[model samples]
Target: MNVFPRLPDNLTGGLRRPNQVRRDQLEGAVREALSRQVAVTRPLTADPAGQAIRRANRIRRRRAGVGIALGVVTTVLIGAGMTHLSGGSDQQGPPIVVIGDPDLSAQPLATASVAPPPPPPPPSSKASADALFASALIDADGKRLALPGVGPAELAHRLPNGTGLLVVGAPTAAGRSLWVAQDDGLVQVLLAGAGQIVLAPDATQVAWRDGEDLLVAGVVGTQLIGTVRIAVPDSAQPVRFVGSSLLVRPDPTRPGHVLWRPGADKLTEVPEQDTLNVYGSLPDGRLVSQVSANSADGTCLALVDPLRATKAARTACGTRLSPDGVGGMSDDGRWLLVNGKVGSTDRSLLVDLERLGTTLDAVPVGPAVSGAVAWTSDSDVAYVDSSGWLVRLNVKRVRAGEPAEQTPVAGIEPGDRPVLVSGS
Candidate 1:
């Protein structure tokens, strides 16, 4: 009986039926080939001469089979735009066939074999772009079905687009620890280190300060793949991420004020302006700031891209920039909430930083609204009130001539566990 039925010519890749027996057969074939390599590298020389000869013959036959199987697998992989095996290995063990390199001069060959035809050219960027919408689908049990070897509990955060980045921390022999995660849940380790990590919007890499020099690490499959250090001043604050781009703020006393470093390739600077206090860079390349110089009657909010002011305007009405305090920007760059001052009293203002730099409304959260002001990607802001209540303030309705209402979003007291609010 035929142990294996031939797969149909019409059965395209990635279209195989679930739990298909052929898939297991293919995996076993590859495993057998790998086992042969291991056996050759660890030869059993203590066996009887007859047994040793038999083992050697078996190794030779298996090696030949592996060479042939490898060629077919390589062809299939190349056609699918997957990774190609590296050309060489540094170990002194018996050789294995690799796809790209033609000159097999390192090891003696028992026999020659035909190389499969090369794969076709890659698809156009437009087509490739459409096909690259990677996503992870999680079941009700909080388990991600598509990502291998990861549970929902392990995920630190999921991007708006659904790609998840997981971090696993383990202690070293000496007592220190390291954490690593796969970048975009692919084979790349996004970060593996002892320092703090900040993932960019693209989720491919991160910017971290190892010590004095700021280093950017590429992620590959729950590991820190590689790192490149960027030149930064000693006085420069620790690294921050603005969509995978590094935002380096040079010392205020230094010649240049704000330096934006995108990966290892470029370092851009915003000319030192007397009025601008470089707060930080937004993912869309805008700066979330309050005006310090020039036309400084009220707080100044500006949109800067590539270190240039794309749009500059002052906020209106109750939204006056507080001299002693500041706040946050919405995820979409649509709003900037400033803890402004109304006369001698300090208040919070929800500034509509999108259409116009106008104060949408102002809410009196009292003076105790000091710590970190939380903006939940929407127009709402949350802060811990003095009465020990986590209050959410929302600019519910703002009409042309109507006063903006300051209503309690949801009050969380000591008893009820405050639900974590995030995302748009």
Candidate 2:
């Protein structure tokens, strides 16, 4: 029978009978010792008291050394474990915590850590594609081109030149859309949802109202720039830009337009008109609009400066305002064209503004309110007749003895009325 010293799983070996073999060997050694009469006696102590004291001291010293060694080992193990947990090794771990996260379980970010790990950076304030929410043509070179319909209502206001901007209307279920064009036939949309589009007198900026908020987006010469929400307290807001100033009209009743410089903070008020709704201003310092009273035709076709009310900015060449006429100012701020059937007369009047006080011939475009009209940047007026023909009227020709009453000066076939969209 093999009797073996059983070992725990921590010690790995095969079974054997070392215990029995050791007992037999010990018995043999004892018998041999007895036979030889080997005395194993204790030697007499010369000083028993001193020996006992020395033995006790040795035992105490051993115990103290063991305690000290145990403490040192424990401290070493704890330090190693902490180093491993703190990313002290070359191994990778989980993501680090950030300031905005709700979870507090993650470890705090280290300020002087040598590791490359750090929190992600915050969002930047630079211009992004998402900032441009919507755009509609505030003014086009020619035509009203209202998004909901396809007639003169669609044409912006025709000018003596072929360039103009279409007034983009409010957004509906169908969507807010406006098309503006110049002689180059380039069309741009200023707003896409619901709102009213208006251009500044300088033709460099466009402003609109979305709900109760006012938004300005426009181009300075060729560079696009604007503010999203310019805070104002009232509704029926009206805005315009003249030179370097921005004017805002924010009252519902007895309202007046406020003017301010773009990069400055001061504001001033524009003079009030008796009945005309102010549409916009011109660079040459003229305000354009339609008459307030439906029955009064004189003021209906009048263009007067708010700064100087006595002097009419524009008036019919020889006759007063036509009863059933529609008009708009040229881009150069020197002419006004009224299109409508006047007092049973079928001729439209193209009035040269400079000749309002002189005897200038009124160009008679056969007595008919055709499509919408707008002036181009180059000073040509474009209109569409009932036949849907695009007519381009030359201001120089009308002034240089070409006769103001020429209806279809030069036009395209009566087919597709291209939607016109202009930059504010």
Candidate 3:
């Protein structure tokens, strides 16, 4: 029956009697909310709230260690400003070197590499006529005059300043003497005879022929000066120094026409009619005579201006020769060397008085051409060839028409008579 019926309000109230007033009203509302949170808390003190919470956790770990030491000093100032703006600071400094002057820089590159020294060798007229017969005091038998007691020295004259040697020597007892031979050893003699020995185009004077006397000597430095003696006409003939005067022929018995100029006393004749002699004087004082309009007409070679008694040029008519023909004038009178005969064959020309008659510049010289014919202080013509050989003919290469050269003078020996000493 109790399982079946429900209790009323008073019944239920009684059952709750054991609630102690609802557990004392829930323990007094949990001690009144823990006394209202212990009346707003406030009671801790280890020393002042435990050093104020250990100084607020050591100032939050010293402000997080000053923000991690200012983010590790701004990553070490951005890696030292990116290693100084990337040039890496010129790897950091110091090193360099240079020097030169080894004694002003040496030299000898072959004397600045070479090139300038080759032009001076053309004057050998057979070595100046073998050095004028090797300084001639004349002794290879007076240079072939065949000396012994001295009679045939025959080279009547020569001294185009190669010093001297005027031998007409015949001293077997001093008969036809005039033997000068001086290269400074002085010999002199003088008592002359068979004519022609005139040297003195400034070779300091020396004219000869002492038979009819016509002396005129003056040479200083080897001594022999002033000797004047002039008594001509015993048929006088050989004597020529023309130009400061003395070109005689007073009257070699007459055919030599007449040409005397010996002033200071008298003899001045100059007719020269068919004049057949006078070979050479020109260095402008002119007088290269050998004229003739008769004996069947031939020889004329003139140029006579014996002080303007005029005839300044001749030589055209027949170009003849042989009044004993043998010409020679070239101590710069330009050149003449004749020696004619042509028909019985003796011929030896070379003319060219600067082209004399417009075209016969001549230059034949063949018929074996022997003995006397010499010039070469570059006028070149030297001869001697009957196979004895000395030879040489150039004549400015035959006046430039070319074919003349010839040249064969090695030791000279066609009996050795080469006389050309005119190097002026």
Candidate 4:
């Protein structure tokens, strides 16, 4: 389309030669912009987005690809008065824009700022189209622990000291069920339709929802002894354990989160925490959850005080908080690993709960918020990246505000979701 209508003979009559020269210069500028823009948009390596088109080509079948969005550039060629343009969004660097027509020769091509290729897929963090989980769980030392349990075995969260585990899988004699594992054996339990089962911080107690009943039992050796079943309110489910007390939700239709003490006959609503969803708890009586839905600040990680419901919380919507009650919190209740957004892409956020404002590193998590992640220690975390390699990193540097690398430990197999055996 013609951006500028042809200047009439009357307008160019007095300056035909100069106008002819100007039109030629503009034509040259448009050609140059088109070439540079093409180079920027070309899929040289041909990746997909979620970081999908970017990730579908990653080490494995990760929905959201590892974040190489650090170099996204948007170039538009409208007309002559305005020409070359590029730069990324929200961030300071790429995806820049040029408004209003200006001198073409005096300006440089923004496309000159091409981004370097994504660091060669993090060495060992590559997976295949068919890759799944490893045969068994992996420990901090990178050793695979294949359970003696027959058929399919998916470890949910490792028990205290990696002594036992909670396994879930396809239908068995136990029906669509949950199992308790120790050594090489598997004992099926109820909670037929449930999610990550949680244990007490001390590991002396275990909790789960069996039908409408919330069962609190003693973890003795491989068996659950002295089981006490407290029928929860209709539709309520057990989420995480704090001290000897269990945090239950009276179904999603309910307003506040419920905390049922060991022998309590009823659910106690945690004051001021009515809007929070408890995912982790601290020995000091604090709780972990996402920001309240009623909040105008948008979603991020938040802490709830069980004792005194008020505190000057730090909030940042730029990066989100991802983990739930599963293997989300650390042994000491200080560091947390969750899925969050780094700019416009999905990434894992290794957050130092004690320092929420500063150490929320927007690290790349292969599976956007899906897949499996387990914590091996307060300073170390393990997970199978999008590439299907089990990686362990010293979270010490990350918590202390330093750089931490996901050191590749072992390659993961297709259909095998690996978890840190000694899940803290």
Candidate 5:
């Protein structure tokens, strides 16, 4: 305590002044000692601000390098992923590649075993005319020689092949049974109580009327496949075959309606506004009918599509007494045979259906006709004269306005009415 010097008490406010001087002396000595120590421990470096800036720059460089390295790693990973997805690999063996949905379990793909469609069927062939007629005619003695259980056939129609014939009214009870005669001397009874038999154009089918019921039978070669009965109006009468279908008309009691069967199953009635008489059927299922005009004495011809019977086309055949009689179409469907009285003379006219508006006024080749007529072929027509003689007329020459040459058919004799069947 005595080693320290004291200041003047009067100038420093006594005891407080002496303590303050001692404190100031001690603080100055400590400050000098700390300055010397700091000087001896300090490192040889640049300014503090420069060092801080350099440290900040180093931090930024480290971050950028880390980012670059991370980017390189990500790029390499992406490249490897793309290569794997693209089926590219560094392995020597074949690479394993997966297709379809990744979330779905792998399955073996199903294979389809499809069979090719069957080849189309071959087209059918048609028979010749001479071959057909040869099968129909009887022997020289005019007797039913080949057909058994048949006596004196009234009407004979040849089948498509020359080996078979369809004969009607063999000398049986009521003359109603139909018989099929073959060239091999085999005979079969096709139907009983049958009338008005008609063969289809293809000769694969036949239709007939048994009183009020209509029967259709299918034929293959010389055998009858089956017969189907179709119910029709009691007044309907079978007229002709429109292809494999059958066309029928009402009797005089029911004049306007016409019925047809698509097959042997059912009948479809044709509607008519006025009284119409069906004369012939076209190959395409159209009907040629006689329609009355303003006067009762006059009539016109109309072409009607049976499927659409409401639509009818009236042609120039509306003259007085024209088409007084109805006939049939030729085998080729080119000519239509129509009969009418021209100036008190019974005349046969051939309408050229193929030529549209052309009509041929046929000259009588034989005696006056008895209204019985049939088409033998595309170019020929056969008609019965009043004397019951059959006359064959050339249709082509008649259409050209030239006189139709007529020839007498040998088998048809005088006083015997004939039914002409054409071999198409």
Candidate 6:
């Protein structure tokens, strides 16, 4: 009765407290989780000034730690191409971390470029040979010599093999007569109606044009054997040999040329061409011709496809040549002798092909007597002078302002025009 009413016994039983041991275990687990979530070394003091000072010190230490980490990141970045940064919630800026070894420096891709092939090697050691000056076969010493089986001829050219000479006579009703002046002095007259005779540069083959028939044969020790006749489409004149292929002009008035193999029927025409007739070929297969039109004076020489068939490829022009002067390339194709005029005088100029495609200037040896010009040696150029003497001019001597060595080649006055031999 006092001031409140009495509680029921059953209510007291239902209001029992939680188990003490379980409650203690649960409280400990909650305390451990709170401790992990927030770490604290010491509790804050009740003084406001002390708490403010402690907070300032903690901030300064954190800034110093981040600075040290940034220094480490900068050192590593010096040796790495790139780096990454990982910042935590508590940090203002984080250090960059590097992974595996990476390229220290990056560069751009390279550009493509190609270089042209080099020129052919020089010839082997010089050989003892004879010079043909105005139809007269003369030795290197400029003495008139005679081939045993052959007599005076109209035109002649040296065989590339230096084995003999190719002699041709005036064209009669039966056509021009041809013969090979052997090294052993045996002359072999050509068989099978050979005309327009053109010998291969290798000296292993010979070819001629007979009507529409193109006759090619193997040269076996001064003999033209194993003849193969192929029918061509036109009256092609044999021009010159570019390796095993024969270069022919389809028409004398045409501006181009075609190449044909002896054993095949296919014809290959040069890609870019002009009216210049290819009279000589380099061992590398470039064509050398005469370009007279639109030049300064005399005759201008040109080099076609110095590299290949592209308009960007250049054409080199030589200096003025004699109006009707003689010119020929050396056997090694290293030097070019053009009958050129300096002033009122005709001089045999040496165009050093080693400096070809660069200059048009030439080295004048002297006045040539006969129109014939030939290479006497790798370094010597031979020509007949006004005294009918064979002048051998060493290029080095001529370059040094020295005189040419003259030898008595012939004593004839005139009427010996048709019997000349040369490598022209």
lDDT of 1 by residue, 47-68 (tens): 6998889999999999999999
Per residue, candidate 6 scores C-alpha lDDT tens digits across 1-424 of 5798677464465466545577789999999999986885666567799879999999999999999999999888854423221212111122221111111112221222223222212222431223212235654455554433234554566777676766655455655556665443233465323457666654567677777777777766545555666677576787667777787777766566777777777777765556345557777777766654455653456666533555313345556665442566777888877766777777777777667663476888776546446666667777666555677778788889897776654554564432335552
Query: Tens-digit lDDT track for model 4 on 245-341?
Result: 7877776655457788876787777665544456577667777666544444345555667556574244434555443333366777877667655
Tens-digit per-residue lDDT, 1-424, candidate 3: 5777666564464344444467788999999999999889586654787888999999999999999999999999998875643222121211110111111113211111112212212324322222223311222122312111234443444545665555444234434445444442223343333355555655566666656666665655334455655677676755457776777766654545334444366566554555667767767666776676654446656666665554436554345555653556667787877766656666666676655661234556554454345555537655554453445556666556554434444444445443323323
Between candidates 2 and 5, the lDDT winner = 5
State which candidate has the highest TM-score.
6
Ranking by lDDT: 6, 5, 4, 3, 2, 1
Q: Give the TM-score of candidate 1.
A: 0.44
TM-scores vs. true structure, each candidate: 0.44, 0.44, 0.26, 0.55, 0.56, 0.57
Runs in model 1 lying further than 4 Å from the true structure? 1-205, 218-221, 238-240, 252-256, 272-284, 294-299, 309-326, 355-377, 381-388, 397-424
**Which window of ten consecutive residues has the lowest lDDT sum in model 2?**
95-104
State the displacement of the C-alpha of residue 345, model 1, in Å, after optimal TM-score superposition: 3.2
Model 3 ranges off by over 4 Å: 1-132, 135-197, 200-215, 218-221, 227-245, 248-258, 261-263, 279-289, 294-297, 300-319, 322-338, 341-409, 412-424
Tell me how far candidate 2 lies from the true structure as C-alpha RMSD in angstroms. 22.9
Q: Model 4 — which ten-residue stretch has the worst lDDT? A: 95-104
Query: 221 in model 6: Cα distance from truth in Å?
Result: 2.1
Candidate 6 wrong stretches, greater than 4 Å: 1-135, 147-151, 157-165, 183-185, 232-235, 292-299, 306-308, 322-326, 368-373, 385-389, 406-408, 411-413, 418-424
Model 5, C-alpha of 343: deviation from truth (Å): 1.7
Q: Please, what are the lDDT tens digits per residue for candidate 2 over residues 2-110?
A: 5996664434565443444577889999899897775666566597888999999999999999999999999999888755544222222221211211111133212
The true-versus-predicted C-alpha distance at residue 317 of model 6, in Å, is 3.5
In candidate 5 the C-alpha lDDT for residue 364 amounts to 37
Best by lDDT: 6
